[model samples]
Target: MKTYQTSHIRNIVLMGSSKSGKTTLAETMLYEGKVIDRRGTVEAKTTVSDNTEVEQMYQRSIYSTPLYTEFMDHKLNFVDTPGSDDFVGGMISAFRVASTCVMLVNAQHGVEVGTEIFGRHAADYKRPMIFGVNQLDAEKANWENTIDSLRQSFGKRVALVQFPVNPGVGFDSFVDVLMMKMYKFVDENGTREEYDIPAELMDQALELQASLMEVAAESEEALMEKYFDVGELTREEMIRGLYLGFQQGILNPVFCLSAKKDIGVKRLMEFIINVAPAPSARLEVLPDESTLECNADGPTVLFVYKTALEQHLGEVSYFKVMSGKLTEGQDLVNPETGAKERISAIYAVAGKKREKVSEMMAGDIGCTVKLKTVKTNQTLCAPGVEYVLQPIVFPQAKFRTAIKAVNEKDEEKLGDALNKYSAEDPTITVQYAKELKQTILCGQGEHHINILKWHLNNVHKIDVELYAPRISYRETITKVACADYRHKKQSGGAGQFGEVHLLIEPFVEGAPQNNRFKVDGKEMVLNIKGKEEYTMDWGGKLEFYNCIVGGSIDARFMPAILKGIMEKMEEGPLTGSYARDIRVYVYDGKMHPVDSNEISFKLASRNAFKEAFRNAGPKIMEPVYSVEIMVPSDNMGDVMSDLQNRRAMIEGMSSQKGFEILKARVPLAELYKYSTTLSSLTSGRATFTMEFLEYAQVPSDVQEKLLKAYQEEEKED
Candidate 1:
């Protein structure tokens, strides 16, 4: 292997929907570059990109795999990403480090949900895009419709650089509009035979060529002036202008390919090496409102974009040199953790195989094993000249489930396994929901969680079960009620005696006022004094006050009473849920100097608070989420109706790129397995995202059922 300069390196990411030939295209690219002797297919589970056991079992990609090949004296680093939205974390990671994105579209299916989703992701990253209309050899391949769909979905900036001359079962050749030549694949061995474009399709090819020229010319003043004067651009001028246009996202050149049959792949490789922007050419925005250029002589700075665990390799961290060169045995400090790490070995990774490299130049992607403190999204730089790169922002987890080890002894193992998986993929989150009393595992969708479970069972040997998570319902009071209790115990020599007279009322956020109540046809006015509000560590607040007068109770005992009340609030009287947003007023109490201790006061306060809470209007509150669903226009009615059935309130509606967007608020209880249901209803075309909004009171019927269930569980326990 030879080391390449930053100017000769091309960092590209292959992105598209699943089964869209991204892996196949990657395999073909490796073969064409002589990095691999043979091409592997997805069906055989031998492709470099989809090498993981989960991916091999499912016959799809689950993680992004980095593979490099040298073409035309340039190093082309290809990050092959998963097409499924369930593993969108991989795609986002790839986009973060890559300078260009080659978005592959299935010719048979044309533009799909994955294509649209990743197109938006590429736009979000502002990465230059090149469209590859793949699977030209498929039986139902439609080149015209696919190109038209691409143009319609992505605007007129999509200009054709190549087109299949005969796209069908025997698809072997495509006309290159820019070169004005026909490239024919003689066989499956990737042997190419060049010829002049056929006379019949010359007009169409010339028209596409003109479109490409117009896009290229409009990107530069010199090119535009030359085009207006001479009505055309020379081949060198066109390539230069198109390269600039591509980097600016003003031109998205579409290339035709049959990755399986090895048709037009070599041409695409040539285009990448010739036209794609090098790492030094791409501008990097810095945190100090300045731009950092990729310079090999500058201070060392690398951004870790992906992390994975191999069978014998421990933890392999893949990173891109953002500013300076990285060499083996170099010491760098992780700015995130302020920990120093020494790179023992550097390897250029190609799927599961790795080639040890002494050094990697700036803008090159490589991996180092066993960095104790370095993790994904961590920036490693020289110790003295410290700088942190922007980390990749992953999407929020949409689907969640309560997970527990089948055998209680393996609970600790389960936690360790989950931590490892979450470290590799940040989109997968594991959290202990104390209020719900369950360990919740959250991911992009059901498939994502299932893969994590598979890893847990097969990789870590920890068997676990996933169930619907419990809703964290809250308990609150609506009205005011007063109760008194006396704790009297004469078990031994010393007696325990304490009496508490407390009034419980609904808490409001403003100034405390007198609470009026009618007791037995008598008006009773209770004045709040010295109110103290303590915010609960979990959520909500506990309001307490000492309205004691005339030495009714010692001031020191008020803290003990409040503590007792909080203990009872932790397990509310209504249904054992945490109580919140309630004020407790201890107006009077009696204490014996010898017997009345903290225990007696606590017991009396707990009993009195429980009695008053039950008498007051207690209600259960459930968590609500704000959901935004994107679906095709035809399925909007069905989706809206389904949301309404879930007791969701339709907040707003809008349109985006031929899709209908529905915004609503729905209770978390109603959203169990909703991702699976939404897929079934919309044929896996609709996508949605949600975030926690606020807690609202549960319906009366739901509250009744929950209370009954809790009571029954308590009895059984």
Candidate 2:
């Protein structure tokens, strides 16, 4: 294969909702490009994009597959991404590397929840888009309604470059307004014939073309002036305006397609090659807020956007050449890790199929196998050049589960497998929660984690069970209290004795320490000699005050006393949960010179802090998350009612397109399996995101229940 220069390369990503015919469209595109002699169907498990075993079993895309096809003397590199929001990591990663997004809109459903979700992502990434109304040959296909929906969702940005001539089961042709030509397919294998536009469709085609030209003229001042003067745009002038508008995200030109029937596939590819921005159109962003151009003559650099563990290949690393040209057997240094690696082989990828290439120029996307330490979101540079590309930030995990191997012996294996999978998909995170004593697996939703489980059970042969993960509740005091504890142990040898008097009070941020306290109608003043403040790891602060006078207790034992207080704080008095935001004052205590060991003082302080904490207005606090849910208007009431039952506090609500945006603050404890429930309630037409907010005190009833449960757990232990 010949190396294509950066100017001859176009990078695009195929995205939309699930079952929107993305895989089939990709197959048809490959067929049209002559990369594949015949198109493969998703149902037959033979499409290049859905080659994974899990994807085949589900008949959907599970990962972003980088595919390249040589067409019109250009290398067209496109990634077919999974449409489900559960697998959104792939789409995000694709957004980072691609120049544009081919948002596939199902002709029958118009704009679905998945479409809106992914479309929002594209807007966030600032990537231009081209709409492909696919499955036009389906019995229920409605081109007019789909176009209306696009206009409603995207406004005037929906520029119609082509419209179906005959939609529905007998769909076989479309009229291209850009060329003013009719494209009629003779068969389902991209065999098409060009003809003049029929009289019946000429008026509509001319109107759409005029509208498109007007939208295009808005792209540049010069184009607008020319269009105003001539009242029309020449073919070349129109192409220039459309290219600029599309490149700047000012217009999203729509096209008609019947991917299964291979109708309009070639025409779409032609438009892409002719009008789409080349790899060099936009500069790549750097970590330091700078930019780099895709110059083949510049220093060689590569950015790995994705990594996958394939059947035979150990680990395939997919990367885009940011600058210069990458040749086989070239040595590059990972500036982040300072580790040197040799690129053994480079291949132009089309799903699972790989074709060996000697070199790939800047802006070209390809894969390389067997790197020592390179991972996704890492950059590799030539020996003398140092460059790091901006990393792709994946969304936070919303669903969590405590996973454990059924067989204890497989624990290590499970850990290794989880680590491997997490590397491949960053959205799948695993952490050992020491507070809960469970290994938690977090993902986008239940379906996301279920897919991981499927791989675990089938691929790794590790039988595991997933249970509800425990919430990390916190404990703190609400008022002031005082207690004194004495530890005395007598034995045949020297006896151990220690006494500690401590006053506990709630700690507020930026509040001054108190030196006087009234206890039992008596005022006790403390001369604080020294103070030590510590920021607790869980969430708050602990201030320890040393108010000992005349050295009643030596300074050496202060640490031990503080340690005892911390130990109690680690396991709160009411429940065995971490405590925070409390201040302790060692006002006075007695110590025997012979029995004043650290151990004795530690036990004494521990008992005293526990007793005082119980007497203090202790309260339990649960984690609250800021949640934003997007649901269709039809299901808004049901979703709202469900959230209310979970004790959610509705913050705000708004409407966008045909969906309602609901914002609420819900406790993490109440959000378990919420994604699953929302899907069930809204028939999978809703989506949501959650982020950790400030922890608030639990309700009185909830606190009582939690205290009782902890007491029972203590008894069992």
Candidate 3:
């Protein structure tokens, strides 16, 4: 393979809703560029972009695939991303590395939830986009309504570059407004016959062209002035203006395409090669707050955007040369781990196929095999250069499940496999919930996890079961109480004798002025021997006051007593849950020099603390999450009522675009399979996101049920 200069390389990512023809469009581009012998379709599972077994099984892309095509003497590196929200991490990773985004919209469905999400992400990344309204040949295609929906959902920045002439069924021709000509596809092989626009559509075409010219003019002051002076723009001037407008994110060019029928695809590729912004055109900020241009001769800097595990090959690391040229044998240092890695071989990737290349220029995406230390989102720079690029931030996992291997011997293998998968896709997280005693696997949704399960069973030969995750409940006190206990045991060889008098109460900072339960004692700060001073670190604290006026308990032993109290807090008296937010005061205690060692005093302190906790009004607290749900207005009432049934406290509500935004706080227990339920309720049109808020007391009935279950488990043990 030949190395292309940065200026002649266009790194673009294709993203949109599912079944929007992204994979088909990618196949068409490859075929048009002669990289592939023939175009493939998603239905046949022969598309280059969706090459994985899991993808082929689902007939949808489950991961991002990188492919390259040489069009118009320019190297175009396209990262085809999954359109499902379950694999949004792949889309995010693609956007992080690409200079431009080509968002496909299903003409039959118009702008969908996936489109809205990808559009927002593109804006967030400041990626210039060209909207491709695909599937124009579908039976229910509505070109006019789709264009209007695009204008309304996105903005007026959407400028039409092409309009389908005979859309739906026999969609073969489109009017190219920029060239003032009609491109008629005469054959299935993408052979087009060009001619003048029809007389009937000339006025509409002229009006749209004028709008396009205005959008292009707004890109630069000189173009704006020239357009105002002449009320028109030359073809060359319009192209330049459009490129600038695209780089500035002030314009979104729209094109019509029937990717399956190979209509207008070649023209779309031509436009991408000619108009899309090159990597060098996008400025990047350096570590020292300095800006640097993408230069092939600058210091070597590469950004690892994706990683995959090939069947024969150990690991394949996909990266883009952010600066300078990356040679096949070049050695670079990972700034994150400070480990050096030697680039063994560079390849121009087309799906799973690899074409060995001697070097990759800046702005070109390539893959290198067997990098031990390199991982996704890691920056590889020249040794001692100390340059670090910003890493991609993946969304937090929303759905969680407790996973266990079917065979006990496969537990270790299951963990290892899960880690490998997690490393490949950061969206899947594996964690051990110590308090819940469950190994949790979290991901975007059920489908995302199901794919991993399939990989585990088919690829790794491991069978596992997934169940609902246990909620992490907590215990805390609501009132004040006092108790005393004495440990007096004599074993002839040694004796344990200690007494503890402690007062336990709920610790609430900034108590009301009129509150009668507020302690009238002076706040005392004590510096322990080997630990930091007590500062109420965990939302509440075990505020211990050394009220030992008569030296009943030694200062050194007080630390041991606090340790015992913490041990008891780890497994609360009422239930085996972590305790928090309580104050303890050791007013008086009896200790023998020989018998009252750390162990004896610890036992006494623990007993006294448990007794006091039982007397105090202990309550069980459950984690609450702040949820933001977006649904169409028609389903607002149903969603709202469902939330209310789950004991959600509706915080606020608002309207965005055509969707209703409902904000609420709901317990984590009620949200175990909420995503699945929400999908069923809204026909998969609604979306939601949640994050952990503060913990609140559980309802009395829920508390009773939980306590009973805990007791039964204890009895069984």
Give a tens-digit lDDT track for model 1, residues 1-717. 899899899999999988999999999889888889988889999988888888999998888889998889988999898888898888888887788999999999999889888898889889999999999999999998998788778988797888888898999889998898998889997899989998998998899889888888998998999999999998888898889989889889999988898888888888988988888886677677577778898888988988888788899999999888898999999877889999999998899888999998889999989999888888899888778766788998899899999999999999888888898889999998887789999999999998888888898898899998988888998888889999999898889988999988888778456667664466776666688888877678888878888877888888889989999999988788888888888989898878988888899999999999888889998889999998988899888889988999999999987888899999999999899989889888898999999888999998899989999999999
Per-residue lDDT over 525-576 for candidate 2, one digit per residue giving the tens place of the 0 to 100 score: 9999999999999989999999999887899999999999999999998889
Give the root-mean-square deviation of each candidate in angstroms: 2.2, 1.4, 3.0
lDDT per prediction?
0.88, 0.92, 0.87
Best by lDDT: 2
616 in model 3: Cα distance from truth in Å?
2.5
Number of the predicted model whose TM-score against the real structure is largest: 2
For each candidate, give its TM-score against the true structure: 0.95, 0.98, 0.94
Global CA lDDT computed for model 2: 0.92
Order of the predicted models by TM-score, top scorer first: 2, 1, 3
Model 2 TM-score, 2 decimals: 0.98
lDDT value, candidate 1, whole model: 0.88
Better of 2 and 3 by TM-score: 2
> In candidate 3, where is summed lDDT lowest over 10 consecutive residues?
524-533
**Candidates sorted on lDDT, descending:** 2, 1, 3
Q: Is candidate 1 or candidate 3 better by lDDT?
A: 1
